[model samples]
Target: MNELQNFDFEGNEVRTVLINGEPYFVGKDVATAIGYQNTRKAIKDHVKTKYMREERIVTPSGTQTMTVISEPGIYQLAGQSKLPTADPFQDWIYEEVLPSIRKHGAYLTDEKIEEALLNPDTIISLATQLKNEREGRLIAEQQVKEFQPKVSYYDKVLSNDALMTISLIAKDYGMSGAGMNKLLHELGVQYRQGGTWLLYAKYQRTGWTHSETKMVPRKDGTEKAVLNTKWTQKGRLGLYELLKTNGYLPLIEMKDESAV
Candidate 1:
């Protein structure tokens, strides 16, 4: 910058000059005091500047290009190179990304780095993930972080006819559909065309008090029902039989003869 300033100006007159496209204030008196000039001369003392110089540096970490520009007492450290070659980010690459890339390509070496960087998928994915993460645009749950504290109700209560259905279940070993139906009827459990109690038992309940059994797949990946049986409801078998015969399982039921 000082070299450019020296190269472009030569005069005894303190000519008004522009730096960085703006006029820089310098007095004819102060100009002489600053050893710039004495009288005002527009031509010979004029100092103009343009795009200056650039450098390509290969550091222990990586390679980067920088640019230089001439301004008042100011200078530009980079020109067209958009990537930063300074600390923080630079250190991260040298200490973090480079190792991963080196391992991916085999070892921490330039050749390995070149090959890893050349891979289109890896480069694009890394760039995109970095951008998204910086902007909080990535879907954190995509890989299932499970960070949120899992919340679930644990205590379970058996319904009035639920145990009755389970009883039918045990009798049939889960096959005797008729005894199931009859027991359902005696219990006033509602049903008609299709038996839903046993199926219901094997599945889950969301709105009512939790079922006695939690529905989960076992280690073999096959789901099985396990009973909790903490609380039980005294069932009305009269209503149970009526509903079982008709397959009318209401939210509430009555076992009284008249109600049936």
Candidate 2:
């Protein structure tokens, strides 16, 4: 840091006030002040308020004078920064959002829980997800230890080779074709719907397709029922609730090239 010093500018309209080793604008009054102390305070006040706090300042003027920046007014700036921090959003997320998702996550899919945890995404959201994931795993592990797994009607249908045809189930389990369809509908299965599989980005559901069921017809004329569910995001994080809690699907490696 440059210190206040006595200097003569050889009587010019423009003059330099050298502090420690830097030049600070001292206003014409302080630049032509009677002594070093006055010149020093003018420069010190400027350094404290402006360049030092706003950013690092460098001067290439003559003399080895360089002042270590000591700006107290910078405290006001320290209170505000460009980089996102967790301070502001901490209260709502930790107290409200995260806990709410954790409570409701079982009914929700992993994707939806993640969405709630990510809504109004702030640093707190990131922290919540990072930490909540660990707690979530622990919570899930405990839930699994207590879990009672059961197969859905779809699973029962899929597992049957002799009754691969929906028509066969309608003949046997179903009272009528429509009654069988009603049973399937009650259990959330689709018979003949077809459309594009991938939803568009920025979809209304925060990048997730509404949980849906579709029945595809195989070449053998019997419908091969498929549960069309996947997370919109690559990690399939949204579906973790379903995967971990309900035990609907087999565990597979969750891909994360971004972490690499």
Candidate 3:
């Protein structure tokens, strides 16, 4: 948890904080800003538990547990909003608030990068620092290339929305890579070639699954072609629902009122 800050959104005071190095908005404040009457109802219906977490924060009285949502959770809630200002609110969050938080959060008035940029000595020192950083990064990459991970049957995957891999889907629901593959097979996914998971032809008929070629470096330091399977947004949501109904996701129960 990071320090909580308040900023105005359409004249409404919205609470924002940083969690795990990423910005998150207070769930109750978000619901209020979006014109929802019941914060708990809005959260329970729309937010994924993985994207929401509870933390104790000190207030005027003492301390209280507050629900906070990551950026993804906020957007998910926005999608469920039926208020007249829903679209504009979503746009304001996406186009304005998020960017400002990301940009200004790193601001340091006493040790400013802009001030350094104006001095020749500082410019030379910065260039040297950048070169060292690049070299360190290259060394790290080379080390990783030298030892590709032994594929785990059940392991968490890390990825963003743009291009999701099998590991990404599995990790989302606390499944292993192998477990996800087995679950997919049970769900009628038939083909998986070269570390890529493929949907059944019937599921693919909707054009929800596709493959793209990505370049991977060989042990000999040459690039090779690798086809990666990706799921469309529709496919991802559908798969999530399928898993949800099947009890693959951990049970998400409402917090006890007394506990809060």
lDDT at position 102, candidate 3 = 49
**Which candidate comes out best when scored by TM-score?**
3
Residue-level lDDT of model 3, residues 99-144, one tens digit each, is 6764633422235567776777865765565565456446644533
Better by lDDT, candidate 2 or 1: 2
Question: Which one wins on lDDT?
Answer: 3
Ordered list by lDDT, greatest first: 3, 2, 1
TM-scores of all candidate predictions against the true structure: 0.16, 0.16, 0.43
Candidate 2 lDDT, 1-260, residue by residue in tens: 33232323333222223333123322332222222235345445433444432222234564443333221212112222222331222233234433444454332446655786677564455456557566644663443223212112223333443313234434433246556445445433333345323333333355433355678899999896665543333123323333345433321111111222
Clash pairs for candidate 3: 153-178, 154-176, 154-177, 155-176, 155-177
Worst 10-residue lDDT window for candidate 2 reads 71-80
Estimate the lDDT of model 1. 0.32
Please report, in order, the local distance difference test score of every candidate based on alpha carbons.
0.32, 0.36, 0.65
RMSD of each: 30.7, 26.1, 19.9
Whole-model alpha-carbon lDDT for candidate 3:
0.65
| Candidate 2 wrong stretches, greater than 4 Å | 1-134, 141-159, 163-176, 182-260
Query: How many Å off is the CA of 21 in candidate 3?
Result: 1.4
